[model samples]
Target: MVRIKQRYILFDILSPPSSEHWEAYSESRDSALLHLHQVSSSEISAKYLLQVIRQVLQDHYGDFGAGSAGISLVVKYFSPKTSTGIIRCGRQHLDMIVAVLALINRLGDKEVIMRCIHVSGTIKKCENVSIKRDKEDIIRMQRKRK
Candidate 1:
């Protein structure tokens, strides 16, 4: 039997500074994302994120070159609150995935940063850690709001 190993990469996204009245403008997660990223839509679905990542990979490596890299990537989760998400990919493609992630400085017209925070062999571990970190981020945001 042939076994395939997969790795889950967790990352946080940082966006440009919002206007002073950002609170008033951000009615929903999508709204906030749209405002922050200056994109036509606020929905950062797994499919959408994957498309963007693939585009980056393609840009760095031409279509055929990217295919030769043998990267099997998927987005597991994405949260606008913490700006954190998870990606699952073949173990062998981790380095290439990281490189592409590092090169992603812009999403649409907005300036952003995609910072990888962790990597794990299992999705459960990634989810647990992401939940913990997300809670901490929420707490920090609350403190800042006060």
Candidate 2:
């Protein structure tokens, strides 16, 4: 029997502007899609990836408004062998990011094994890292013993 391990990765755009804000919105969308494609092609399964992406979008922006608002470009990827999944949010909303991460953490205690999650965004002057890690390096470091 082939031992299979499931991994879930969540990528959020974190405040994608409406289409009216085209210049900034388009750039943000492109950057996010590129990053997700790069990450997903590595080893993630496309089917599962799509599932997560759909769920996140529905959860954040209601299914009714996604199509009309031009936020319907979310991408997903899956690996054929192991079925590893990656979900990339088309337009990132900061509040949505917070909600998604919180949900992931809650679910992490359950069945899903969150192998790797990446969130990219510009930091505002007043925010702090709740899941402390070196911002310069994407590799998350656990808290060191004092």
Candidate 3:
């Protein structure tokens, strides 16, 4: 007989946005929150979470791909209200939590930080950024190659 083990990774972030803030952004925030539960372990899924973190970091720090420095920013700004003991898990899951927490700290927004901790899935790539360029920009650069 063969045995297969299922691995579970769970995290939670507690950022208590005020009623006023929630009311103002409730629709969009709720939509994003709903999507979090749908996240899964796939390249595309990891990429999407990365995209969200990148946007949050850029909005707060005005840059992306900041590496460890960025991680420091996240940890410094996002205060940890509480953290469950690190259960024995894969390094990937632990790394994801670290990266997410770092970003939350950088934002210095407790509400957002809390929400991020609860984000679904493990952040696979902590340092990769998705490059979004229009077709014209791509062609212009390709033409410049010659």
Candidate 4:
């Protein structure tokens, strides 16, 4: 049996800077502190994300685009606080998948921008890029405070 090559794309989910700046941090951490799960967590989950992508795929490229790109598409990780996530897709459909991601202008009711970071053959590299970007965001946030 041959293996199917895959690519992991790191993307940032950016929404308009909310009037409530600490909302993301509090929403993510408050639940953790209670050791309880929020019934409808404010976090943008992978499942919902996949559904949106599939819907958009169908809208833009019809069933063919959705089927071809949805083969192995998945949101690997999503941190609402930082608004960052990773998605895995088949290598053969990288272009179409990325286009779908770029085409995504909103998630739910909120208007958002999806920015593609580094696309890598390995999830580890994609993860590294995710961590590095998070760190930069933290630093930038800190500077604003001081």
* TM-scores for the candidates: 0.74, 0.30, 0.24, 0.77
lDDT (C-alpha, whole model) for all candidates: 0.76, 0.36, 0.35, 0.76
Q: Give the per-residue lDDT digits (tens) of candidate 4, residues 1-146.
A: 99999999998775544465545545654332222211223746888988988888889989888888887899998776566778999999888888988899877777676778889999999998888866775676576558
RMSD of each: 5.8, 17.6, 16.5, 7.3
Worst 10 residues of 1 by lDDT: 32-41
TM-score-best of 1 and 2: 1
lDDT by residue (70-111, candidate 1, tens digit) is 357889888765577899988888888888889998776666
Model 3, range 57-97, lDDT digits (tens) per residue?
A: 45654544334223432221211222211112233334544
Least lDDT summed over 10 consecutive residues: which range in candidate 3?
Answer: 125-134
Best of the two (1, 2) by lDDT: 1
Q: How do the candidates rank by TM-score, highest first? A: 4, 1, 2, 3
- What is the C-alpha lDDT profile of model 2 across 1-146, one tens digit per residue? 95422222333222223456555445554444333222222333454344554465466668653443224233344333322333344343434533544444212122232333444332221123313322422332222211
TM-score of candidate 1 versus the correct structure, residues matched by position: 0.74
Worst 10 residues of 2 by lDDT: 122-131
